[model samples]
Every structure is written in structure tokens, then in C-alpha cells.
Target chain A: MIRFEEVNFAYGARSVLRSVSLSVGFHERVAVLGGSGEGKTTILKLILGLIRPDTGSIIIDGDDITRRSESELRETRMKFSIVFQEGALFDSLDVKENVAFCLREYTDMSEDEINARVRHILASVGVEQALELMPEELSGGMHRRVSIARSLALDTPRMFLYDEPTTGLDPVNADNICGLIAELSKNGKGFIMVTHKVSDALKVADRFIFLRNGSLLFDGNRHELLNSDHPDIMIFINEVCIQGPSGA
Target chain B: MDVKRTISDLQDFYSLSLHGLLGIAGRPFYFKDALLQMDYAGAGSVVIVVIVDLFVGMALSLQLAAELSSLGLKMYIGMIVGISVVRELGPVVTALVFTGRVGAGMASELGSMALGHQVDTIRVFGLDPVKKLVTPRIVSSLIMLPALTVIGVAVSLLGGYYIAVFVSHQSGTVYWTSIRNILTVENVLAGASKPFIFAYLISSICCYMGLSTRGGSVGLRQATTRAVVMSIVMIIVADFVLTRMLLYVLGFSV
Candidate 1:
């Protein structure tokens, strides 16, 4: 459903992504794992057409978006929804308004219909009581769930991108987010989660792609990731993943 | 070069202003958003304009009366107060006050949103942030600045009236008569025109400063300050240009 062909991107003299390439198919939830500043989030940005690659093409839903203008790329982006690293809820709006944002903008659904779906999605995320609360009033976990609900409010989201959704949270909240990802996975929808959480990734990811220093280090299923002979990959999967920082 | 930077800034502001206005006329507009913003920026700022203009009028009358009394022209103080407030002080002061209040608010609110990635979320959802954020502000500023200016001019004239009649011992009827005679269609047109442009200048600059914010908290702070400072500078320069143009266009002496 999404493909990055030899993508290269940089900020001034500092390179962020280098000749990296990967593809995600339908029914596959790929987790891109790396430590901080390893271009994990950049992949989401490239796919969203928020930033263009220095070289290579980002194809989403069979359309190349590397050079698409901002206005033109918006149509291509309608097929995808993203949850930013910080949940990115609009502070001026309540949870109800935040979740109903895209629906009100893009859908012709009546206010009551929109409210019904918003209530249902908020319930699914376990935050229906938070519907009237402002973004600042919600807990970290509730904010993350509301952000997800906002993304899900869109009509057809072929791909969902989550950037460190569980980055700043207790284990309980992290598990709640993992459960949400797991639930989304069961629907056979494609997802690309950029996180440093190894245990979280293992909990919800069907395939893992590890990015290191702007390059792809490993790409395989869970069985292959655990059984691989690569020393650092093994150390990471066994030791670091178990004991390393969950949100670095 | 400072000259080069000024030219570039003006060019960029012009382009953004065009885009902001286009969004007001384009499809998918949030009319409710624009109305709410007008209430937020316009109606919200009117009281301040009136309060400030009233005191300014009193002070202006006092100073002008002192100067005129020395020359035995104390009776003409109303002409100076009325013309100055209408032709210059009213619009400019209202804009500066609004810049500090409403303009700074636009910058900080939008700046915080940019830092929080809400702007990016709007983009990812295939919505234009310019339309969602900038247009409403521009629309409100466009509306409030002029209305506030008219109210401000009236309040200042009333303030001037108190000072001229009681403080300076001038006849109230004579003072109002001079003001009524000098306040022509041309004078009203000239006084009323600048606020519209200043409103656009302040809102657009602040919005641009906000949308281009970088870093995090520190950047938001800088964007807010820059929005006010840059807008003041922009408003002053625009006032000078517009004043000169309107003076000539309305057939008044520059």
C-alpha cells in the first residue's frame, strides 16, 4: 500500500535519511524502530508528502508523491491519516470538536450523524466521558486516544501512520495504545508506526523494520527478528528491547 | 542588506496577504469561524481603543491648548484635536493598540498551535491551515479596525470637548462648530481608509510570523514578539505611505 524507493533527505549538511527503501503491503502492520533522530518519523513525513525526498520516489496507493505540489498532494493524503508524536489535538477545541474535525470538513454527514460516530469512536478508545473536555483537560492517554479517534473519523483511511503515540506514558497507557494498534491490526488495515518501543512493537507489529543511522538494518517478521543471527539485532531484540528505553 | 530584507519582507507579506484574502472568497470557508474571530478580535478590542483614545484626546487637547494659549489661539484647539484625531491619531493609535492586544493574541495562539503540530495535523487531514487559521484573523481585523477607529474618533472628540469647554474656557458650541466645518467627506474618507490597510498589515504579518515559527516554546515566544514588533514597524510604514497617498488622493495637502 506504501513504498519508499531509495529515499534520501537532508537538512542542510546533516543527512537524516540515506538511500532508504521499503514497501508496506495490505494486511501488514510495519513498525519502524530506531532510537531518537534515526529518521523513523521522517518516513511518516515523506509518505504524507509533508516533506519531499532529496532523491527517490514515495508511492502511496499507487501514486508517486515525491514531487507533488502541496495542493495536489492533499488529494493523495486523503487516503491516509496520521497521529503526530505529541497527539497534536487542537487546544481550542473540545474532544468532541477535535474528533469531528475531519468529518465536518470533508464529509457531508449531518451534525447528529457526525456526533454519533464521534461518540462511538470515543467509546471504542475508552474516552467517551472526555467528549466535552478540552485537549488540555485530558490525560496523556486520553489525548492519544482522542487523536487516534480524530484520524479514524476520516471516511477511508487505507494507511494509518502513528509517530510515537506511546512515547510519554505509563506502562498502563502504553498498553492501552498497543491494544488500540492491535485492534486496528485485526481489521486488516495497513499501518506504519514509528517508535522506539521494542516491547510495544512486538506486541502489535506483524513485521518490524529497524532503521539505524538513516539506513534500514533489518526487515522481517517477528519470528525472523527473534531468530536472526545478527549480533546487534539479537542483542537489541533480547536485551535492549527488554531493558532499553521504551521511548528514546 | 536591510534594504534587501525590507523589500523581501514586503514581497512575502504581499503574497501571503493575497492568499489570505483569496481564502476568504474561496470555497469551504468557515463563516462561523470568521464571525467568531470578529467577535474575538474586533468586539474584544473596542473597549481598549475607546479607553486609550479618550485619554489621548484629553492629553492632546491639553498640549495643544498650552501651545495655542501662548499665541492667543486657544480657541482653535478643537480644530487641531479634531483634525489630528480624525486624520491621523485615531486610525494609527487604534491599530497599534489592537496590534498589542489582538495582533499579539493571533501570533501567540497560532504560534503555540504550530509548535504543537496542530497545524501539521490540519495539513495531513488535507485541510489548508491558511484558510482555517489565517483568513478568520484577517477578516476580523479588517472589520474591527475600522469600526474601532470610528468609535475611537468619536470618543476622542468627546474627550476633547470636555477639555476645550471646561478646562480651556472655550464655548462648547463654537468648538463643535469648528469640528463640524473641518470634518468634510474628504477628511472622513482619509481618516477611515488607513485602518483597513493597517488591519490587513497587522493581521497578515502576525499570521505569517506565526505560521513560520520554528523551535518550540522559545520559538513561540520569539514569534509573538516579532509579530508585534514587526507589525508595529509594518503598520507605521504602511501608515506613512497610506497617509501620503490619501492626502493627495482626497485632495488634501500632504
Candidate 2:
């Protein structure tokens, strides 16, 4: 459903994405793994058209988003939802308004209907009774769940994007989020999660692409990744699971 | 800062302002946000406005009454205070106060929002940050700055009236007539005109500073500080230039 064809992007004189290419099928749960500052999040930003590729194309379900205008990009952007690393809820708004934001901006839904939708999404995310709570009033875990609810608020989202969704999360919360990702995949929704958290990826992702120095270094399933002889991959996997069979 | 970089920054600042103004004209008008900001920027400012403006008026009268009494020109105290407040003090003080209060407020609010990735959230949801964020502030500043200036002028005149009656022992009717005769539509136009421009400068500069903020919480603090200092300086500077222009255009002596 999404494809990156030899995409290259730069920040000033420094290249951030270099000849990078990848794809995620409509039902695929793909995790892009990288150490910090390896340009993992930039891939999500580019795919969203927040920052365009300098060269090559990002085809979102067949549309070449690289050449799209701001108005065109807005139309394309609604097809995908992103959960930012920090949750990114509107601070001025409470949980209800934050969740209902897109609908209020884009839809003609009545106030009661919007409130109902927001209530439903928040409940689904296990955050009931905090509908009137402001973003600052919520805990970190609640913020993440609220972010998820906000993203899923969009109708017919073709693909979801997560930027380090598990960063700073406790193990139990991380597992719950992984379960949510699994559930979304079960519902036949594709998603790309960028993270350094290998356990989260192992729990939820169907495939992994390891990033190193602005390029894709390893792309494979969990079994293939664990069995690989790549030194860096072995070291990373060891960090996640100290009792790995391929332990160094 | 490099001269070229400064020029580019100015260009970006104006671009952001124009985009925000355009957002006000476009669809999906954020009437709720505009009203909320009006409450914040307008209604929320009453206490500070009252406290600061009342003192300013009282101080101007006291200082003028002291000086004019020695020359036996104490009867003209109301005239001096009236002209000064109407022509300069009222609007300038309002802008300066707004810079400290509303300008800093907008900067910190938007700065933290940027830091928390809320601005990008608007973009991710396919909403323009200009529409969602900047326009409401601009609208409120436009409505409120002028509103505050008028209040300041009225309170200052009342203070002058108090000083004239009690301190100078001038006739109430003469004191009232002195100020009333000097008050012209042209003078009102010249003074009243400034807050409109001042409002835009305060709102736009703070919005730009707030949105362009980087680093982290420290960046938000710095942006808010810069927004206030720059807004106050611009308000004062713009006041001078605008005063000159308005005087010439309205046939008032500069």
C-alpha cells in the first residue's frame, strides 16, 4: 500500500535519507529499527509529506506524493495517521476536543455525535472517565493512548505511522501497545513503526528494516534477523535478549 | 546575526503574518478559538490594564500638577494630561502592557505547543497551523488592543480630572472644557490608529517566535522572552513611526 523508490532527502548540506527504498503491504506491520539519530523518524516525516524527498518518489497506495502540492498533500495526509513520539495532543484542548479535533475541522458531525465518537475512541483506548481532562492532566501512558485514539479518529485510514511509540514506556504498557498494534493488523490495517525498541518490534512487527547511516542495512523477518550473521544485527538483538542463541 | 540572515528572518516574519491574515479570510474560520483568544487577550487583560493604567494616569497628573503649579499654570494641567494621554501615553502604555502580558502569553503557549509537537499535530491532521493557531490570536489582538487603548485613555482623563479638582483647585467646568476642546476626531484617529498596527506586530512576532522555537523547554523560555522584548521594542518604535505618519496624513502637527 506504500512504496519508497530510491528516495533521497537532505537537511542543509547533510544527507538524512540516501537511496533508501522500502514498502509496506496493506496488512503488513513493518518496524524500521535504528539507533538514535539514524534518521528513522525522518522516513515517517517524508512519507507524510511534511518534508519531501529531494529525489525519487514515495508512492502512497499508488499516488506519487513527492510532487503533491500543499492542498493535495492535505488530501493525501488524511489517508494516514501518525502517533508522534510525544503523543502531540492539542494542549489548549481537553482529551475530548483533542480526539474530536480532525472531525471538528473536517466533518459536519453534530456536537453530540462528535462527543460520542470521542467517547467511544477514548473508551476503546482504555481511557474512560477522562473525557473532560486536559492533555496536561493526563499521564504519559494516557497521552500515548489518547494519541492513538486521535489518529484512529480519521475515517478509512489506509496506513498508520508510529514514531517511537514505545520509547520511555514501561514494559507492561509497551506490551499493551504492541497488542493494540497487533489488533490493528488483525483488522487488516497496515502500519510502519519506527523505533529502537527491539522487543516491541519482535512482539508486533511482521518484518523489520534495520537502519544504519541513513540507509537500510537489514530487512527481514524475526527468524531471519536472529539467525543472520551480521555483526551489528547480532549485537542489537543481544541487547534486546541477553539469552539469544546467537549470543556474542 | 548575519545581515543576510536577518533579512531572511524579516521576510519569514512578514510571510507568517500575511499567511495568518489570510487564514482569517479563508474557510474553516476558527471562531471558537478566536472567541477564546478574545477572552484571553481581551477579557483576561482587565486587571493588569486597570492597575497599570490607573497608576499611569495618577502619576502623569501628579508630575504635571507639581510642575505647572509653580508657574501658576496649574489650570492647564488637564489640558497637558489630556493631550499627552490621547496622543501618546494611552496607546503606547497599552501596547507595552500587552507586550508583557498577552505577547508573552501567546509566545509561551505556542512555544510549548511546538515543543510538545502540537503544531505538527495540526499538520498531521491536515489542518493549517496558521488557521488553527495564529489567526485566533491575530483576531483577538486586533479587537482587544484598541479596546484596551480606549479604556486607558478614559481612565487617564479621569485621573487628570481628579488632580485638576483637588490638587490644582481648578474649576471643574474649565478643566473639563480644556480637555474637551483639545479632543478632536483627528487626534483620536491618530492615537487610536496605533493599537491596530501594534496588535499585529505583537501577535505576529510572538507567533513567529513561538512557532520557530527549537531546542526544548529552554527554547520555549527563550522564545517567550524574545517575543516580549521584541514586541515591546517594536511597539515603541512603531508608535513613533506611526505617530509621524498619522500626524502628516491627518493634518496634525508632528
Candidate 3:
């Protein structure tokens, strides 16, 4: 489980998150909805210990990781994986090497074992054919899938932080990524995804949390989110669902 | 300054530098990368050194020939060429060439990596960016500059010797014998020594400027320019200070 208590974060003189608090339980697929510059990615960064809160503590699996040393944090970071917006795959490395990076760095597996594990994960992500392709040669969808395969290499029982997982994908690819999130959650892995995609959030998220002006405006189950009369949520639903296939 | 803060800063700087150095040291077979860098730095800049050394050597021979002939000391032309090229021109010119050629390229490459968040990604993946990226550059530059200096000395000596013996019609035997007689082991060592320090300064300054880049693409360009200019200035300043200190310590008057 991950929890943020009264977190305050600022950039220079401007406050981004002002005493905001939230908790994510294990195996909970939570969709964080927010407009641009709403500090959603900042929240994920704080939870990942990439940045520390100015005046609060972040607890991950019962440890306050805000004060941990770099080595200690790096060790603890093996418990979670992040899929960045750009996939952040090393362009210099091939697909197999990219997926095998975490395994090679943190595990004592032999090259044969690492290759086998990489093949297995790539197959799980439906990217078995892209074993030797460089990241530049892969499509956007393929890149996202490769990043997912890489993220799942560790198989840790913690969380997945996705930053705009379906941003540049076509509708079909976005839907596939959404389905992947749902399937992963069904198999009991905590997922915290930040997106502007309302339909994807509605389809995959068990719960929805809306972030605005550095604060949480709504936090409830999917049904509650759809049934509620909140004007903002209704506007979001209407714009994403009724306004053609522009969501892609 | 607080002792603790000073100590912490020193530790961080040393740790970063050592990390880079160790990463480079472990990868001893990055010879291809080294040769690529050397070609970019040394081979690409050869034209400029050749041009400048040709004119400088000609002018030097002419001036020394005139001065020595008036004083009945025309036999000292080879000595002058040997001392000048071996002691000063070789290392300084090679360093200047390196500063313009490789220093700017390194700064820009690393700065772009910083801007693209690639450096941060490497750190998050628990790899030291400095070690993986910077140390090899430092090590390669250290080796290349000295080697280039030796080459520069050879070329300049050949240029000056030709100007003195053929153009000025001096005896070839006189030229070779005077060079052999006048140049000492200390002068060669002194010239060779400066390039290592020059290479270190160039690598370190470029790396520092690169790592300090902010903003984005424009910022990276600015950092690259600053790194080249600063590296050239620092090389000259360091050369002066180091030469003076070494000479003083060696009981030389100038």
C-alpha cells in the first residue's frame, strides 16, 4: 500500500500540491483524472520517491521512503515499476536488452536465464517478434508494449505507475493498453494510471480520483463517478464519449 | 564555511569524478570509441595546425636566421627550432585544436542527454551517468592529447627543418647535429607533460558545463559554446601557471 499524508510540494515560488493527502491500497486499479498541469504526474513522482514532499511523509509498504538513502531507495524501488509517457526505452539498446535491463541489473540470472525471462515477458506482452528490434524501429504501440514487458520483468508485488500510458496511441492501441491495465489488476497488481482519457478510465479503473489545483476533488468507485451529478465529471464524459473519436 | 558542508561538497565532487574515472577504467577495450573521438579531435583539426605551424615555423626560422647571421650565430637555427617546437608549440597547439574540436561536441552531447531526461533515467535505473558517460571521455582525451602532441612536435620540427635547411640553404648535417646537440630530455618531458593536464582540463570543464545545462535545446547550445571557450581559456591559463611553477621548481629563471 502507498499513502501520502498532507503532502506539500512546490516549484520555486509556486505551490503545486498544497497539503494534499491520498492512499492507494494493494491491487487497487486507480485512475487519476486531471487536466493539464494538475500535478498528477508530480503525485506519482512523490510516491516513487523521485521527489520528496516539502512538509509531509510518503509511506510505501510501511516505510517512510522520503528520508531513505539513495542505495536504500534504489533497493526498495525494485518493488515497483513505472511506464513513462514516452516509454523512455533506451534508443541505443534493442528490445530484448531494454526489457532485460532491470533483470540484468538487479538479478543474478545468467545471460541464458535473462534471455529466457525476456522472451517470456515479451511473449506475455505480445511482442515476442520484436526481440532484436531497436526502439527507434518499433511503432508507438510496440514501444509501449515493450516498456510494459520491461516493467513486468521484476514481478514484484507492489505497484505500477503509468504516466499517460495511452497518449499517442490510436484508439485500438489505447483500448488494448486499457484492457492490459484491467487484466493486470484482475491478476492482483496495484495500478495508478494518470490520463486524460475518460473512456479508458471508465473502462479500466475500479475507482476514479480527480485532481485539480493540486487537490483531490473526487475519489470514489467507477459507478459513483458515472452516476454522480458533478458538472465537471459530466462534462468530461460528454466531451470524451459524445464528441466523436477525438479522444485518441 | 561550515566544515561539514565543505566536506560534503568535496565528497560529492570526488565521488562523481571517481565514479566517472572507474567506469572508464573498467572498460579498457573501448578502443574503437577512443579512435573515433581521436579522429574527430585530431584528424579533423590537422589542417588548421598544419597551416599555422607552416607559417609560424617559416617566420620563426627567418627571424632566427636573420638574428643569428648578424651575430655570427647562424649555426643555432636548428637549436631554436628544436627548443621552440618541443617545448611550447606542440602541446599548446594540440590542446587548442582539441578544445575546439572535441570539447564542444562532448558538451553538446551530454547536455542534450540531460535535457531529454536520459541522464535522470540512467540514475533512476541505478547507473551513475557520470561514470557511464564521462569517464571514458576523460581517459581517452588524456591519452590522445599527449599522443597528438608528440605528432605535432614531429610535424613542426619537419616544417622548421625544411625551411632552415632547404629554403634558407643551410647544411643538413648542421641542422641535424645542432638539434641533437641542443635539445635535452627535460625539454621533451616538459612538452609531453603539458598535454595530459590540458586534456584533463578540457574534459573536466566540458563535462562540468554539460552537466550544468538547464532549459532545453538552446541551453544546451549555450553550454556547448561556453564549454569550448572556457576550456580553451583554462588550458592557456593552466599552461602558464603550471609552466611557471615547474620551471621555478626546476630552478629555471624564466
Candidate 4:
């Protein structure tokens, strides 16, 4: 489980998260929905212990990481993995090396074992053909798939954090990624995704979190979101409707 | 430059450099990465060092012979060139060139990694960026710079030899003997120590700049430029300071 208690964050005077508090159960599938620069990414980073809250505490897997040293945080981070917005693949490494990185670092697996494991993970993610290709050679969707494969390299990580995973891609690729997330969600592990794409979020996550101006405005399932009377929530739904009619 | 910012940067640089040095004692040392960096910093740099130092030695010999022949001291050309190149020019020029080649490359590569989120990815995988990236670079620079300086000194002596024995018509035996006689223990120590210091300064400065990169490509370009400029300036300044301190400590007449 992960818990944020009255967490506040700022970027040198410009507050991003303001007295925000939330929690995620071990097997929960959550989508944090917000506009651009509404501190969505900041929330994901905080969960990963990538950045600390200015005030209050964050507890991950029952351990408070608020003031933990970087070395300590490294141990905590082993419980989770993050896929950045752009896939954030190591440009210098080929897809195989990137996917095999964590396994090689933390596990005593033999070379053949590591290769087999990488191949299995890549096959699971449907990017097995990209094993020898560099990051630049992969398509946008393929890059994100490879990123997901890399994240799944570690057997111990129980939660996955996705930061705008489908932000920049064509409709077909976006749908493919949404489908991938849906497929991964069935594994019974926690997932926390921050994205502006409401339709895609509605497709995969059972719980939705709405952030407006750095504070949670709504937190519930699809029924509550569709039936919400909050003016801002209604405005957001209407705007998405006006932009394009979504099935969700 | 803002004085406060400059001081703050220095403090950060010192802290990071100290952390990098201490990392040598930590667990999970990346020996393979260090060896790869050594190849990049040492073997990749030999040809350039040899060529540059050769020209510099030849130029120094030409000027020194012209001036010394008038004073009937042309045979002393090897001594002057040897002492100057071994104690000062070889290390300084090598460090400056390294700052341009390897140091700038370090900053840009790391800057791109920082921007691309690869550094953060390393952290997420339970790895220390300092240990994984900066330490190997610092270690490689520490080992390679001094080795290159030795090579530079030897090639420089050969350059001086060619000018002294062939161009200036001095006896090859006299020139070689003069170099052998002038390079005392103190002079060798002075020459040997400067490369280590310059290597530390260059690697740390470049690594700090690379990891601190912000914005985007513009920020990366600025960081790379700043790293090269700062390292070059620091090398020259450190060379002067080390020369003066080594002279006094080694009991050489100032």
C-alpha cells in the first residue's frame, strides 16, 4: 500500500500539490486525471520517491519514505517501477540491454537465464522482434511497449507507475497501449497512472482521481465520475465531449 | 558571474567530487564500466596527445636554440625543453585538450541522459548515478591523464631531440645527456602530480555540469559549453597554483 498524508509540494514558490492526501491499496488500479501541469507527474514521482514532499509524509509498503536517504529510497524503489512519459529508454542501449538492465543489476541470474527472461518479458509485451533494435529504431508505441517490458524485468516489483503512457501517439497506438494496460491490470498488482486522456483512463482504471488546481476534486469509480454534480468535473466532461465523442 | 552562484556551484562541485572519490570504497564497483572509460579516455587520446606535444616541443626547441646560441648555451636547449615540458606544458596542454575532448563529451552525454530521464531510470532500478556514471568517469580520468602525460613527455623529448640534433646541429649525445641530468626527482614529482589534480578537476566539473542539466536541448548545449569553459579555466588556474606550491614544497628556487 502507498499513502500520502497531507502532502504539499512546490517548485520554488509555485505550489504544485497543496495539502493533498491519498492512498492506494496493494491491488488497486487508479487513474489520476488532471490537466497539463496540474501536478499529475509530481504525484507519480512522489509515489516513486523520486522527489520528496515539502511537508507531510509518504509511506510506501508501510515504510515512511518522507525523509529517507537516497540509499534507503533505493531499497524502497525496488518495490515499484516507473514508465516515464516518453518511454525514457536508454538511448545508448539496444532494446535487449535495456530490458535486461534491472535483472542484470539486482539478480544473480546466469547469462542464459537473463537472456531467456528478457525474451520471455519481451514476448509478453509483444515487442519480441525489437530485442536487437535500439530505442530510436522502435516506433512510438513499440518504445512504450519496450519500456513496459523493462519495467516487468524485476520479479519483486509489485506496483507499476505510468506517467502519461499514451500521451504522444496515433489513435491506433494509443488504443494498443490502453489495451496493453488493461491486459497488465489483470495480473492483480497495483497501478497508478497519471494522464489527461479521460477516455483511455476510463477504459483501464476502475478508480479515477480528479485533480483541479493541485487538490483532489473527485475520487471514485466510473459511476461517480459520470454522475458527479461538481461544476468543474462537469466542465471537464463537457470539454472532452466537445473535443471528441468518447465511448466512455 | 554572480559571486554567490559561483560560490554555491563550487561548494556543490566539491561535495560531488568528494562523493565520487569516496565511492571507490563502496560495494558494487563497476569495474567493466571503468575499463571501458579508460579505453575511451586513454587509448582514444594517445595519438592527439603525441601529435600536439611533439609540435609544442619542436616550437619550444626552435625558440630556445635561437636565444641560447647567442649566449653560447645552445647545448642547454634539451634541459630547458625537458624541464618545461615535463614540469608544466605537457600536463597543462594535455589537460586543456582533455577538457575540450573528454570533459565536454562527459557533460553532453550526461546532460542528454539527465534530460532523457535515463539517470532517473537508473535510480529507479536501485542504482546510484554517482557510482554508476560519475565514478567510472572520474576513475578513468584519474588513471588515463597521468599515463597520457608520461607519453606526452616522452614524445616531447623526441621532438626536442629532432630539433636539437638535426636542425640546430647540436650533438645528439649532448642533448640526451642534458635531459637526463636536468630531470631531478623533484622535477619528475612536479610533472607527475599536476596531471592527477587536473584530471580530478576536469572530470568532476564536467560530471557536475552534465548531471545538473535542465530545460531541453538548449540547456544541454549551455551545460556542455559551461563545462568545457569552466574546466579549461580551472585547469589553467590549477596549473599555476600547483606549479607555485610544488616549487616551494620541493625546495626549488622561485
Per-candidate TM-scores read: 0.95, 0.94, 0.82, 0.95
Rate residue B35 of model 1 by lDDT. 93
Single out the weakest 10-residue window by summed lDDT for candidate 2 chain A. A239-248
> What is the docking quality class of candidate 3?
acceptable
Clashing residue pairs in candidate 2, if any?
Answer: none
Give a tens-digit lDDT track for model 1, residues B65-86.
8889999998898889989999
Runs in model 3 lying further than 4 Å from the true structure:
A107-116, A184-187, A228-231, A243-248, B1-15, B22-77, B171-183
Query: Which ten-residue region of model 2 chain B has the weakest summed lDDT?
Result: B159-168
What candidate 1 gets wrong by more than 4 Å, as runs, is A229-235, A239-248, B1-13
By DockQ, the better pick of 2 and 3 is 2
lDDT of 2 by residue, A37-146 (tens): 88899999988898889999999878998988777888778878999998988887899888888888778999989988998988888897889999889877888899
Better candidate number, 2 or 4, judged by DockQ: 4
Residue pairs whose backbone atoms clash in candidate 1? none
Estimate, for each residue in B51-88, the C-alpha lDDT of model 2 and write its tens digit.
Answer: 78878887898998889889999888878888899989
Question: Candidate 4 chain A: worst 10 consecutive residues by lDDT?
Answer: A239-248
lDDT of 4 by residue, B129-160 (tens): 99999999999999999999999989989999
How high is the CA lDDT of each candidate model? 0.88, 0.86, 0.79, 0.91
C-alpha displacement of B120 in model 3, angstroms?
A: 2.1
Order by DockQ, highest first = 1, 4, 2, 3
Per-chain TM-score, chain A, candidate 2: 0.94
